[model samples]
Target: MDTTACTILLVDDEAANLDLLELVLRPRGYGRLVRVADAREAVAAFEAAAPDLVLLDLHMPHRDGLAVLAELQARVPEGDFLPVLVLTADATPAARERALAAGAHDFVTKPFDRLEVLLRARNLLRTRLLHRAQRDARGAAELAAVQGRLLADEW
Candidate 1:
């Protein structure tokens, strides 16, 4: 997979965190990154970018990450996969549970290891892209079957 082809939305209320994320991802050839500092703007950014993966902060002003997750859940089409990785300072089990329940695919605490974050992001993106490929293949196969049936009917 082309790392550059995958667009990642980096959402954090803190500028430093966003910069750190960019620093971490850019070196790995993830060139298409959309950074959103305000939690309130995350949904709009998500809509505009259609990112393959999201790095979200749990606590933010205006709207919390859970709210953003809920909005994203509603916006995402059923049966489609959009990976959300929660990155926050909250390490409590309850926080993790809440985030997972709210549609986050993975959670990492703040002061996270660079390698761990990178690996998690890579894994999520891999699964998401593979799911997309499988979906597309199924659609193509279904179209072909319909075309075949139409041809048979004509004959």
Candidate 2:
């Protein structure tokens, strides 16, 4: 697999939240972090960067994380398979279910353990990278099949 270092996107409306995320993730060799202060911009960033992991905050101005997650799921198949780790203060079972239903891979409540968050982030990134490799391989195989068919027709 020709996989490179994973890229992570941290989405929240709070500057302090971004600061904390960068502080925690930077030392762990997480050098490819894309931080956005608005939840609304997540989709564009997701499309443009195709991050290996997304750390989505539950609440925000304009569009919340849940809303963004919904949009994301609609756009892609098996959308929740992308390793979405939601960060929020909502500990309610209903909220968690909503997240899970909306395609979140895991939930990390606010005031969470720093070490635990780091571990989760690393684990999710690994999963995403592997998934990406698989997807790329499948795409290449499909393209080769189509090209072979075209060449056979030409002959």
Which has the greatest lDDT?
Answer: 1
Residue 105 lDDT in candidate 1: 99
Instruction: Return the lDDT, model 2, position 4.
Output: 31
Q: Count steric clashes of candidate 2.
A: 0
For residues 129-150, what per-residue lDDT tens digits would candidate 1 score against the true structure? 8999999999999999999999
Q: What residue pairs are clashing in model 1? A: none
Q: Would you list the C-alpha lDDT of every candidate in the order shown?
A: 0.93, 0.84
lDDT of 2: 0.84
The lDDT of model 1 is 0.93
Q: How many angstroms is residue 113 displaced in model 2 relative to the true structure, after the best TM-score fit?
A: 0.8
Task: Residues 1-155, candidate 2: write the lDDT tens digits.
Answer: 22236788899888998899899988877888999898878899888887778899988889988899887667666633577899888888888899988889999898888898898888887787777678889989999999999999999
